[model samples]
Target: MSAWHRPSSRRDLFRFAASAAACAALPGLARANQRPEAFTSGEIVENGHRFFGSISRGLAEGLEQANKKWGRPNAYILGQEAGGAFVGGLRYGEGKMFTRNAGQKPVFWQGPSIGLDAGADGDRTMMLVYNLPDVEAIYRRYAGVNGSAYLVGGLGFTALNNEEVVVMPVRAGLGARLGLALSYLKFTPDSTWNPF
Candidate 1:
């Protein structure tokens, strides 16, 4: 082959293998750096938690009538699911992440979703539940259910043009107060009947 298009040699293959091995170990290294009891022992480290709490209170107050009408608010829950950066879309990535593990229960709650999008990179979303009734229902179901459940990600607080999910944009900066950006959504009873 010409110098412009030469076939890779065995030395090149070895170098490629070494790089691949190192790259593959990165995720393992990241996990190893994490203390096993970080969540149990530490206070809220991510700003996302503050927003979640505030939104929960708002939903409880704003959607009171809807909560009473439903009589059983089982879909919205106030809990945290450890999420990592994903490929494809957020929903698909979240579903894949949940399905990968065994004995995981699903919770369905919609409030405000905050996400960041850097150029050419996939977005990471943080969702907050405004309705306490919905939050309680999700919590109870997760606690009682033994098997895994499917999780749908990102029910934006505001529906886009009355169709798409509403997304509250979060700017990327160093500790620039984010919890204040929580958006309120009007609670509407889901028409589909869920067995759970």
Candidate 2:
């Protein structure tokens, strides 16, 4: 049998170090990627009030509406946004996607809208996410029509989707707002001024 020997060349030693570092990082990476199991309707409503700092009846109704459409979402985003319009407009926001096992991921989103409702900007968004298979799914563009405000399509329901994943953004300040505009939201890992 051959006995073990020290790595002879610098190249051999470098390769050994690289392999060791990867092996050491494996466990931490696995834990970081773990996903959450589920979300409850009560938690959704409770968090809505807590996140936006109010317990209004309109907010309660809005959350209930989303719950009915997509029961027990697996994820959610809690954050604020800014936008305005006389006719055509643009919107931008940043938030954290909360999944118990996967942890909070900082995500940024921006959308351009035409013929959307004109309103004052306020503490503006929380998204209820459904059928998100994994966190990587969140880093893509989603499309939906926003042609109704509040009760028309269920709580600022900008029902955007990319393949199997569905994202319905609920606005606390508007109570629910939408209009006859086509909007597409592109999510990025980093903050960007470009909303295209």
Candidate 3:
């Protein structure tokens, strides 16, 4: 009806097409960028029992706290690790990353800590994975803090992150270890003694 209401020129038509294309693509882009569906509390609790052999008070506490703070997880790592901290220390663990979209792959992680910390023992570790876009994305450095140890020794609520991916490790009845440390965990495809 009017010049402003209709495509008046070739340039205007091209711009309109571009806008339409972008709008059409928005949904796919959103789907592509969306992280996988997270694990529910019921699922986590069941898996937690299976992973740790039994659900303890420490495990329950950590899981509840983590779930409340970060929602849920789309992937997870079940493994064992050992380290002792006396002022500074290193931790190493190997496990398999399980994801509905990416299947499962072996993963190894090592981390170093520094603070007024002390203790040592090896324990089974279950890391609840969140914001993981893919399996390969898990292989990166995630910095975290063991700021507190709950219910004696079940440490599971520590948040390790690399801006994009977050791994919340939940360990229960692992050992007689305790301390507070700022740490960075580097995950790799293979095992290495290096903790840097």
Maximum-lDDT candidate: 3
- Root-mean-square deviation of candidate 2: 4.4
Instruction: Give each model's clash number.
Output: 6, 1, 1
lDDT ranking of the models: 3, 2, 1
| TM-score head-to-head 1 vs 2, winner | 2
State how far residue 185 of model 3 sits from its true place (Å): 0.8
Best by TM-score: 2
| Model 3 C-alpha lDDT per residue in residues 66-157, reported as the tens digit of each score | 77777678988888888778889888999887766546779999989999787776768889988788666888899978764543455456
Candidates in order, TM-scores: namely 0.21, 0.75, 0.75
Model 3 residue 64 CA deviation (Å) reads 3.1
Go through the candidates in order and give each one's C-alpha lDDT. Answer: 0.27, 0.75, 0.78
Residue 91 displacement in candidate 1 (angstroms) = 4.2
Candidate 2: worst-modelled 10 consecutive residues by lDDT? 148-157
lDDT of 1 by residue, 1-196 (tens): 6545333998887887887799999986664333222111012113333544333443333234332432322112123222221121111112110111122234432232223311121223332222222111222211110111122322222211112122122211111111212122222233212223
The digit string of per-residue lDDT tens for model 2 on 1-196 reads 6665678999989988998899999986885666555788777778887776654456677667766876668889988887655577677899999986778899999878777466545546889888888776888999887655543223354688888788988765553344577778889889999988
Quick one: ranking by TM-score, best first?
Answer: 2, 3, 1
* Alpha-carbon deviation at 83 in model 1, angstroms: 14
